[model samples]
Target: MITTLRFTMLFAAALCAAGCGSDDEPAGSGTPGTGATTSSQASSGTGSGSSSGSGGSGSGGTGTGGDVTTTVVVNEISAKGSDWIELGNPGSAAADLGGFGLCDSDATGLCNTGDALRFPEGTELGPGEYLLVLGDQAVEVGPGPHTTCLAEGPSSCFYATWKVSASRGETVFLISPNDHVLNQLEYPMEAAADGQTWGRLPDLTGQGGVTAPTPGAANAAP
Candidate 1:
């Protein structure tokens, strides 16, 4: 809130300064009103004219602005029993859900279409919290930082309906709120001699990566 207000104050000050400089002409000039006052002429008038106009304009506004420094982070992705994608908002301001989306890649291509879960008018994810979304539903619907266990049991299987079944070498993708791909997981469905089945790759942030298992056997968690 303070950040947005600060930006607004700065912007308003700028606009007022810009407007004041153009308001000191005569009644025929191209200044704000009908007046003709050149720089030399206005400079000669009482400095009070510029200062007064600036003060008036600056004090006339509401002094409010929208969110600033807002961002969304993909914290975790699970495609097992119930496909669930977890998002974290580590920003100072809340994010609007109006323009977010989720998409998948396949032969048919990006097949997600439904209502988008918009952060409610005052919905904010407070810093360091998670927004867990069930894949099958619209991207806009989810358990935000303030929600309990999806209103379902603690098994996490509530998301099972959204899981993407993997073949021996298939892949799964977790898209962003903008429908852009966030991360992908390519793993071996069948366990190897080491007993570890592939999981989501590590070290993925803004782009992409491969999902591989750590030093463990199949059924090991990522």
Candidate 2:
């Protein structure tokens, strides 16, 4: 009886050992190596997605650009001829000179207005190009802010006169149609009678030669 009992106990111990080994093999096969492979693939996919997203974000916003500028060079105030307002383009790119204006303190009709000048739409002034807007009868050149000059120039086209009765000198302010103060000149120490030009010549006296512009700045020398 004792021998039989010992034999049964040894068989039971062997069965338990076999069962443990069987359970361990599946745990090894289903887990460690497979789990690592899956994790690595998931990480690689996430990395690729992040990289593509960043690349797309970097390619989204970009434009073409150019510049336009105007300068007033007061050539000569006329005696019998029409008063002249000289316009010049000093920029690299061509600019539309439409919707521009010129004004003086004393204007009749549209002669004195801030919205006086009207160029053809898309009228581009190339670098160093110039145009002369005859300050005719519609434009009464005097002092102060005015808005009718350009609108009336066509009407005053018959007689655009800027006759200044100078007392020593006079001041003429050229306000742009854009409301930009383009040029201002104070003619001093001259005759106080009509006929003399209100501005300094660009070549000789430097008094009325527009604003002596800073290089690279608006109104700068070409």
TM-scores for every predicted model: 0.36, 0.37
* Model 1 alpha-carbon drift over 4 Å, by segment: 1-70, 108-123, 137-162, 168-222
Total clashing pairs for each candidate: 18, 19
For residues 116-185, write the lDDT of model 1, one tens digit per residue.
2333333334444445555565334352333234443222311212343344323333332333332233
| Window of ten residues with lowest summed lDDT in model 1 | 52-61
In the order shown, what is each candidate's alpha-carbon RMSD?
Answer: 22.3, 23.8
Q: How many angstroms is residue 162 displaced in model 2 relative to the true structure, after the best TM-score fit?
A: 6.5
lDDT of 2 by residue, 37-68 (tens): 21100111211112111111111111111111
- What 10-residue stretch in candidate 2 is worst by lDDT? 57-66
